[model samples]
Target chain A: MNRDAPCQDEWSILVVEDHPATRQFMKLRLRKAGYRVMAAGDGREALEILKHHFCPLVITDWMMPEMDGLDLCRAIRQESWEGYVYIILITAKDSQEDIVRGLEAGADDYLSKPVHPAELLARLQTGRRILELERTLKERNQEIARLSITDPLTGIYNRRYLNDTLTVEVRRALRYKRPLGLLLCDLDHFKRINDTYGHNVGDLVLKEFAGWLQGSIRGGIDWLARYGGEEFVLVLPETDLAGSFDLAERLRRLVAEKVIATPAGDITITASFGIASFTPGGPENHPAPETLLNEADQFMYQAKKSGRNRVVGPTGNQ
Target chain B: MDIENTARNLGIGRDELLEVLEIFLEASVADLEALTEAVAAEDRSRAGAAAHSLKGAALNLGLTEVADLARTLEMAAKDGVLLGAEGQLKDLREKLQDLTQAIQA
Candidate 1:
């Protein structure tokens, strides 16, 4: 099958029938319609093909040798596969009881053979359209997932993403006995900067600082976020105090460089950061995540108290 | 919440945090002192590291303003760029000294 084409990649149709002649005819018709066709002589072979291949559309004869179409249809329904599998029961048996049993066996729809090519084509088209819609929905879902994690303003991770991902990182740090560092950073007197200078200048300063942070940061695994307001965050997995301190200083220095351009004029801004690391500082020995955050908050305030545009954490010397 | 319980939840006792803050303050003074001397001597790395250490100490205590000042000094030193704002550094140091005293209190 030439699956190189986008339309043909998932365009496989499985045909199962006991009678070889009729099966061959159906195969010819489906192939003509640009469908890749795989046929099984009976139910058993059909099961093997289904197992090996992801056949999203299946057509089977209602009565066949050994395991009939009804049993095969039931089996397909029971097994879990992501793609939608359309089963059409081809039978000369058109009684209401027979149709009920076929439907009960999970035949998506029924067809009485001497199969009508036009009807079969219409049904297959419907299945194809449904699958196409499903594919579009799946892609949209993935795009939404990507957007949810990103902060629109700074093009960094958003706080919601940080909180969820960090909870997992926190547990992993505890389990693996590796250190994780959290840097909680906020602009010093940011509210004043915004209130006095107006939001435009405040926004320009934020963008400029974010650009600096984006440059100094290395590695894909390091997660950065604008926590909220003037606050921003970084989660350094597998980073001890030593590593985090180095990065934090780099970040602090980068933010302190100079004035960011704004419509009003060039205005200088500074930030303060509080750093905390996994220091056997679990609930028992020290405190929980919130408590640790509080400590870091206090430390950041201390940084503000001492001077702005600084990084602080547990002393690496200790 | 009961006032006492709420206070406790707020970590009002300040035992471990205080100890941690005290160590940080000690480190801060030493760092600021080093930074002051280094700036006077035009020793960039020494000045930067000193400012950097105080910055870290300030961060631990949630002193944003002080940390920002120290960070500014640290960055200038890191770039081998001496800040023209010499007076700013002096003012920051005095403020940091005041913070060390406040943390003690």
Candidate 2:
């Protein structure tokens, strides 16, 4: 289960031959060539295996009972799988027309039998290279997706994700008539620090602050996002007004008590919090996300005016 | 049959080659019976289909003589030339028998 190493299962090959002897021999040869091999008596059994297992490379005989290699290739192409499958047809039909038929049937390659073990191995190396490139592309696409939703400076969920997720969470809370809590937090006098200390120190403090907030939130129940510069949003699912107020106070104290070691020197900072909760009354009582967010934003301004480093909302001044 | 060299080229050992030959011998009995029945019924398409499968199986095992004989029979049936096909089938039977006995030995 090492993340750094690609497992044998990823490079496994499925050998489908109707003849038992050929299937066994091909399995032995491929295994000897350092491939993990699985054999099927015919295309029908091969299709069944493919449905449950992830064998990206298939070596199949063209003439088989029940189902043949061309039929299997067509069926594989029809499937809506997440990964690509490479198919090689093994047959004695070496005519140009037969090769064209195989290619048109969605086969990636063709091998004439009596199969040369060296040639078969070489073709499989080509399959391996193609599969490896596909894997790398898929992995990169996933990483790109993750990066698009993340904030580069704070390394937390960005504002775009926050907006999209908030709408979905609001709809779910409304549909289920469940309580949902939101906290809008802002670092006090952040602009002053950026001007006096430097932008580098400001960025360092922002990253550290985001890390502290991320660590404090419940892993699955709560989510934190960098809403914008010096501002953050915390989403609490299934939490009432009282619960939100309690969490807000705890968050405020945690930030106030922590001292950040900046490049200038060890400095102390605090954040202001605005807590809001939506208790779904009925279809008529469902409010838009902007309405709830604006309420929280107004409360955060109130907390700042009353003197920064405090919480305000339904359970205000707690 | 040069099965030793075939096995070497196939990257399998002698034991593995012998096991494959035994399996092919057992399976070919049923295939040969099907071929005989198709020929007796004078079903050209069915005979060609049977020969095609047997040829593929023999070729995979490096039984070149058996494969080539089956191939000729298949081509004759495909062209609707069933004349002398019985004699060709007889030749295929002898070759299959020789292959079976040699593998057994």
Candidate 3:
């Protein structure tokens, strides 16, 4: 895939040098090259700037008052940052031992001073290339993480995500003595629709149903997940049985009324909803995630038996 | 010093080189004072640090005479010998004055 061209203005290079004239010269040259520049008098000041602003590239002088370039490299490596910092240590010391010491202290590259502006810019371009590679890899890893927890068809949370998070929600609710509600829903006669209108139409109808339910729920407070084919689970925190029952009833009617349009034809479908809730002082023993799921599953089975397209709660069918 | 050639070699315009030279002149004066005090007190580390700072800035601006003198002074201070440091400091003052006049012209 073609990516957007990298903008030079977005690449900020931090210059750490104790000499005022040299610092000014570096800032001037880097700014002329279209890069954003930040300057510090010494390594200590550089650390202070880094605390507030993120700079991926650093050009430092080896010998400085208070903290030197080597110490700065070590300190930066010790602290965990959101992204990698590429350091280029600029020094007049050209000995082999000094180069090895600089690298050992975490300098990605080294430059001998007096640093020609052309050479400095070239080295920084190298640093930017590496930083760009790191950024792309990090973004791809995050995308993979997101895909692992997302359902491919409906673009909602998958069963694996539900299993992992539901346990955490249960622990949190119990620890905080807060009420939690779980709803298990199944599309009524989903397989029959697949048989009558082909699986393509059935898939479209399922997508429509999932989208409708996802839009109707509280975004961050409540979450909906596809438990399996034609079955979904909604976990609601800080919600009691009565609240969940009302929501399930409302959703039952909405699903029954929605007409889903597909390439084959338009189809109307209804869903059966079952809700189970945990109150702080309830008499239910050991309200684990499995117990809640089983209770909701039982109520959903009851709703399916009672002619379908209805909502069932712990109290009774509605 | 060939100001135009130095500016071109450093990848900057002559005007920008002049601006940096002005800053260099001001900073080197301070470094010179610090070096003077360090030589009077026979403080080897302070004298070496002062000379090192001067050498770095002068070298960046392509002031060869100033940089060479400052490097010599730095080496002497580092080795804990201030024998010729006073004369070198005087010569460094004269070189900086000559640079200021050249830039002004």
iRMS values for every prediction: 38.2, 7.0, 6.9
- For model 2, the superposed segments whose C-alpha errors exceed 4 Å read A1-10, A282-284
Per-residue lDDT tens digits for candidate 1, residues A1-318, read 212112455489999975543455556556756788999978889988988987889999866668889889988888887777888887756899999999999988898744556567778777788878888998899989989998887788887897788788777777776677888888888888789888878877777777777666666867778888788777788887778888888777667776677887777777888888785564434335675566667778778777777877767211
lDDT of 2 by residue, A238-295 (tens): 9988889988999899999999998799878999998778987733377788877888
- What lDDT is reached at residue B72 by model 3? 95
Query: CA shift at B97, candidate 1, in angstroms?
Result: 99
* Candidate 1, superposed: residue stretches over 4 Å from native: A1-10, A143-149, A189-220, A258-269, A280-287, A316-318, B1-105
True contacts kept of each: 0.00, 0.72, 0.63
RMSD of each: 43.0, 3.8, 3.1
lDDT of 3: 0.90
Which run of 10 residues does model 2 chain A get worst, by summed lDDT? Answer: A1-10
The best-first sequence of candidates by TM-score reads 3, 2, 1
DockQ of 2: 0.52
lDDT score at residue A79, model 1, on the 0-100 scale? 89
